[model samples]
Target: MEGMAITRTDMLSVADTVAREKSIDREHVLEAMEQAIQKAGRSKYGHEHDIRATIDRRTGEISLARYIEVVDEIENEVTQMTLGEALSEKPDAKVGDFIVDELPPIEFGRIAAQTAKQVIVQKVREAERERQYEEFKDRVGEIVNGVVKRVEFGNVTLDLGRAEAVLRRDEIIPREHFKRGDRVRAYIYDVRREQRGPQIFLSRTHPQFMAKLFAQEVPEIYDGVIEIKKVARDPGSRAKIGVISQDSSIDPVGACVGMRGSRVQAVVTELQGEKIDIIPWSPEDATFTVNALAPAEVSKIVMDEESGKMEVVVPDDQLSLAIGRRGQNVRLASILTGWDIDIMTEEEESQKRQAEFNERSERFMEALDVDDVIARLLVTEGFTSVEEVGYVPVDELASIEGFDESVAEELRARARTFLETEAERLDTRRKELGVEDALAGLAGLTPAMLVALGEAEVKSIDDFADLAADELTDKEDGILKSFPIGEQEASDLIMDARVAAGWFSQEELDAMRAEAAAAAEAEAAEAAAEAAAAEGAEEA
Candidate 1:
C-alpha cells in the first residue's frame, strides 16, 4: 500500500466518486480526509503534539504541521509556549498566535489507511442522514410505498429506496402481517431526527391512511371536486369516512363507492378487507350523525350542545345494528361526527321520558301541596320547575283545562310560598356551611348553587375563586353537579368571585375577558370549520 502511488488527481477523483455515491458534498468528504490525515500525523509524531492538516481545494495537495499556541504562561512544553519564546520564532507573534512547523508528508500505512476509511464512512453516513432528514421532513402526511427490509419482533423496517422507515407494531393494522421483501403502503405520520438517524414512522392504522388511499383511487377526491371531511377507523375491521362535494351534482358517496363498489373494494382489499362506510358529510351535527350511522335508521335525536353530546333514538330492532359488534359501529360514528353519542331504542327512550314525567309530577305535588291529579295535569302542560310554576302568568295557568282563574291564583299562591320556604332553607344551609355572602350574591349563582358549594366545603370567596369549572360541572365529582349550570356559566361565576375577592380589578378582569373572548372567537371559528369538517368518546 505504501508503494502504490496515490496521485493528487486520483485522490480528488475518488472524493468526487464517494460524494456522488453517498449523495453528500465533496467538500465534506475532503474535510473528513483532512481530519483523518491530521490524526495519522499525530500518531506518527508524539501523541502530545498538536497536529493539523489541510488539503488544497484545487490541487488536492496535503499539508501537515505542528502548531504551538503563544500564551502568557506556558502550560504544556510541546503544544503551548510563552510570548517570549514565540517572539524568538516570529517577531510580531502575539499571545494568542499559533506558531506552525511544517512536517514531512505522511505516506499511508496499513493502519492509517484503514483509519481514514472509517472516518470517511462515518462522516458520509452523517451527511446522508442529514440529507434524508431534509428531504423527507416535508413529505410527512403522504402515502409512501416501500419494501419490507426486516422484521424485529412485531415491528417492520421498510426500505424506502432513498431512506428507511419503521412500521411500529401499534401502528400496524390489527392482525396484519409483513415479512421480508413484502410490498407495503402506509401513511408517513411522523419523521424525527433521532440519534441513530432520521426516523420515519409509517402507519397502516392511521385514519388518514384510508383517506390517502381514497385520494389515490378516487379521481374526484384527487381533483378536489370532492373532499374528505373526517375519518374514523377500527383498523382491519371497519371504518367510516365523511366526505362532501363542492359540486352539488357530483354525489360524494357514489364517487367514493365508484361503479358497483369497485373503488371502495380496492381500498378494502388493500386494508385487508376492512369494511368502509362512506358517510355524506353535512354542516349540521344531527344530519352528519345520522349519516355516519348508516344501515341503522334513527327515529329521533336530542343534542346537548354545551356538553358536545347527542342521544340517538332508534327502533328497538335496529339497536343491535346501530351499536354494532362490541359497540364498534356507534363508536366509529361518535368519532366521525365528533360527538359523544348515546344510542337507545324507542322503548327505552319512552321509558326514560315517562320516568322524567313522573319525577316532575312528584316535584309539583310536593311543592304545590296538590294531589296527584292536579300535579300530573300541570306536568302534562310542560311545567317542569317550581320557579316556572311560581312565576308563570296567571292567565297562562288559568288557560289549562279544568283550571279557572280561582284555581290558578290558589296554585300560584302555594307555589310562591313553597319557593320562599325552600330559598330560606337553602340560604340557612349555605350560612351553616360558612359560605360568604359575597359568594352567594355573585351573578349566575342561585341560593341552591351556594348551598351545593357550601356543602362541598367551598366556603369562602377565595375558595370559589380558586375553583375550576369542572369542580362545579363535572358529572361524577362536582359541587353543583345536579344543577343545570354549564361549564362556561360556571367559569364566568368563578371569574366574578375572583373579582369580588380582590384578585384583580374589574378593569383588569375585563381586559382578561376581552383577550379570552378574542381567543374563544378564533377557536370557535376553527371549531365551526371543523364541525363543518368533526372527536367524541375516543378518537380512532
Candidate 2:
C-alpha cells in the first residue's frame, strides 16, 4: 500500500483476488483497500482496525477472528453472544468465535457507532469504483445515449446509465448546445481508469459520426449496395461525401440523397443544418473532377494527368458561378477531389483567334486604299490580305450580315483588276511616298484601336504626322490612357504622320486645318438659321 501496510490476512487475500480478476497489479488493489479501511477505521474505531492481518505467501490462506462477550442475556448485542446460543453454534461448548466466551472491558457507545459508520462508507466507495471500472472499460468507440448533467469549462458531463462521461470542447461541434437533462448521443472516444474514478471521453465531432448516421438511416449504405468511398468535412459548416454503387442500376448519389433529399437532410439536421454535397465517386479522374464541381455546368474538361490537374471550361456566363464567392467552391472541390481545377471562358478563346488575323491585314489594306471593314471581312474569308481577295470564300463572306453572295463574288473579282489598274495610276505616287511594300508586324494592339484612329482621319503614317501634339491629344479624352503604348513609343509614332499637303511638319498643318474647318462650319450654320428666321418674319 502507498500510505499504509495491510496487516489483516483476510483483507490482503481479498485484495489479491480482486487485482487478479481486474487485471490490475496487486499493489494497486492493496492501496485502494488500505484507503477504504483507513477511512472506516478512523471514523468508527477512533484510531484504526487493531486486528493485525498478514498474508501466508505459500498457503494463500486467510484467517480471521474477532472477540465478543459470553453473557447469559445480551445487553450490548454487537459485543456479546448469549452462552446458550454460542454453544449451539459450535456444538463443542464454545461461547465465542474468537478464543474465550468472555466480554471485553472496553466501552461500547459512540466509538463503536463511529467504527460501524466508517466501515460501511469505505466498503460502499470501493464497490462503486470497481463497478465503474467494469462498466466503462469496454465502451470505447461505441455510441451511447446520455443526458447532460452539467457543463464545466466547456466540458459537458453526460449521465450514462451506469457512469458519467465527459465530452470535451475540442471534441464538440460548433454551434451545438445541450440544455440541462437534454438527451445527447455521442461516441465513446476513450476510457481512463484513474485513482478517483473511471473517466470516459465522448465525441460528437468525429468523421465516423457522420458515417454512422448514414449507416443508420440509408438502407443501401448499410446493405452495401452503396459504399461511402470517401468523406471530407468542414464540420457544422459543410461536408462532401463521395459514394459509389455496387449494383449498376442503383444510383449512389440518389441512394444517399434519398427521395427529395430526405436522408441527407436528416443527417444535415443532426449536424445543426450543415450542408452536404453527395458526389458520385468515380475511378476516372476527369469524370470525378466534373462531378466534384457540382451545381455548375462544364463545357469541357481538359486534364494534365501527370500533375493530377484538370481545367474546366464553362460558358462565359457561368464563369462566376463555377468558381463561387472568393473561390470557395473551387477550393472545397480541390480538397474533396484531390485535384487542382481551373475555369476558362468562351469569349476569351474567340477574341484571341480574331486578333491574330487582323495583324496580318494592315499592310494589304494600306496598299489597296481599302477601308478596314472590307479588309477584315476579306481576312475572315481567308484571303491572306486585301491584295489576295480574288479567291475569297464568297459563301463565307455572304454569311456576314448585309452582303449578298453575288456582291461578295463581284468584290473578289474586282479586287485583282482594281489593284493592277491602281498600280499603274499610283506608280509615281507610290514611289515618291515609298509605299510600295505594306507595313507588317503591327500586333500588340487591338483592331478596335486601329479602326477608331481611322474614323478620326488619322489613317497612314503621313496622316498621323499632320497632327500637332495638342491636336492629337484633343482627338480623344484621356487618349494616352486609352492607348496601350508607353511615352517613348507614342513620341516615335507621331513622327511618321503626314497630311495631303506633303508638309513634313504635319502636326502644325493638321491643327490649323482642324481649327479653320470648325470656324467655317459654325459661321455657315448660323447664317442659314438667320436666313430661315427672316423668311418666317416676312411671312408673319
- Positional deviation of 396 in candidate 2, in angstroms? 41
> Model-by-model lDDT, in order?
0.91, 0.65
TM-score of each: 0.78, 0.43
| Candidate 1 residue-wise lDDT, 187-267, digit = tens | 999999999999999999999999999999999888777999999999999999999998899999999999999999999
Over 4 Å off in model 2, which ranges? 1-141, 189-199, 300-313, 325-328, 340-540
In candidate 1, which residue ranges exceed 4 Å CA deviation?
1-7, 45-50, 68-97, 368-540
Residue 267 Cα positional deviation in candidate 1, in Å, after optimal superposition = 0.7
Q: Name the best candidate (by TM-score).
A: 1
- RMSD (Å) of each candidate, 1 decimal: 6.2, 31.4
Per-residue lDDT tens digits of candidate 2, residues 1-540?
A: 233323446556776676666555575555554444344433444432233222345453332224455677667665577777677656665543432332122222454445534553455556667777787888675778999999888889999876888999888889787778999988887888887788888888876677778877899887767888777666788777788988899988888889899998999988888788889989887787778778778888777664455778879888887787678667767777887787777676456546767675675566545678766765765666545565556786577666788867767667776667665555444334443121111333234444445545454555555555554333245243354454435544454333333555667766776888899999999999986885566456
Checking candidate 1 for backbone clashes, the offending pairs are: none
